[model samples]
Target: MDTPSSSPYGTYVIAVRGFVAPFEIGVYAHEHGRRQRLRIDLRLTVRRTAPRFTDDVATVLSYEGLVAALETLSEGPHIQLLESLADRIGDLCLSDPRVVEAEVSIEKPHVFPQIDAAGVTIAYRR
Candidate 1:
């Protein structure tokens, strides 16, 4: 799953999810002491026909590679906010030539004791 971004869309989109990756991705003191699980979801826009009809794998994005690159990012130093992380992820998605747009969501479940779930989401286009 480790490779530079690429796209095969003439006009298509892919929704991909990489389950919880433990990260120190918050501003609070307690949040920095240990890693917390974060879920990453991506909505990638691409062209549908060009690659599908051509039957060329290289004509489209590589889901495996995308996941690997993201995983590498997760392994790095903790970020302070999901907004920044989502921004970085959106940039990464745009790295693919076929991608016209991307929306990224980084979620931290149970962020607040009283709430059922809370996290952050961000989107980018190019």
Candidate 2:
């Protein structure tokens, strides 16, 4: 089967890393009633016609748009699972016709003291 990574069109990568935010997420009882610090990292692969010099922002994918989409998702109802959150992010990234694939990672920085962080990573392709 043809894959997004193997597409014939030139691929442009957009990434956002170390995006920390307060989120209400988790399945355990202690995880309820408050928001925790969550770090989100995303990398998107978009299929573009070709590279050309253009001053217009509309012609190319905007990182602001990706952040806006994430903000919108974060404003929605509480999410219980990291997998679900990753899926939602992937869906948002894929919503753009130009986007061919997305890789998302969600981390809870304060979950444990011994370890750095615990989280989930997922990938989706159109």
Candidate 3:
């Protein structure tokens, strides 16, 4: 029979995809005073502290908490670069001790009509 003790390592992922937020950020004059919609995609790779499936919210990384944190970040002062925004998100995800890695991507869809989107992707590992 398979037992929890036989294989102790476990991992899980918490992700927020296509989370759109209006951000007042850009270096261009046209992007100056108004808020532009930014789509945020985040993935967190987490190592389980315990082997068993406790089925409890407290024992797992809560996407709700992450979303709340992201909301807070979006409400902050105007940002100058998409890279900066991605770094801030990486910091927030990696704050949890169990998080092994964080991958963040932010896209500006309306910046141009020729392409789908334009932005940056950043990854943080520990």
The TM-score leader among the candidates is: 3
What tens-digit string does per-residue lDDT give for candidate 2 at 17-97? Answer: 988777788899887877788899999888875565377888778889888777777667778999999998888889888
Please give, for residues 27-122, the per-residue lDDT of candidate 1 as tens digits: 999888688888888888874545445676776686877788788987889789888888888888888766777888878888889975677777
Please give the range of 10 consecutive residues that has the lowest summed lDDT in model 1: 1-10
For each candidate, the alpha-carbon lDDT, in order, equals 0.76, 0.84, 0.86
What lDDT is reached at residue 7 by model 2? 50
RMSD of each: 5.9, 2.1, 4.8
Clash list (residue pairs), candidate 2: none
Per-model TM values vs. the true structure: 0.83, 0.89, 0.90
Error of 1 at 12 (Å): 0.5
Error of 2 at 50 (Å): 3.2
Count of clashes, each model: 10, 0, 0
Ranking by TM-score: 3, 2, 1
**Runs off by more than 4 Å, candidate 1:** 1-10, 48-51
Q: Could you give me the TM-score of model 2 versus the true structure?
A: 0.89
The candidates, ranked best first by lDDT, are 3, 2, 1
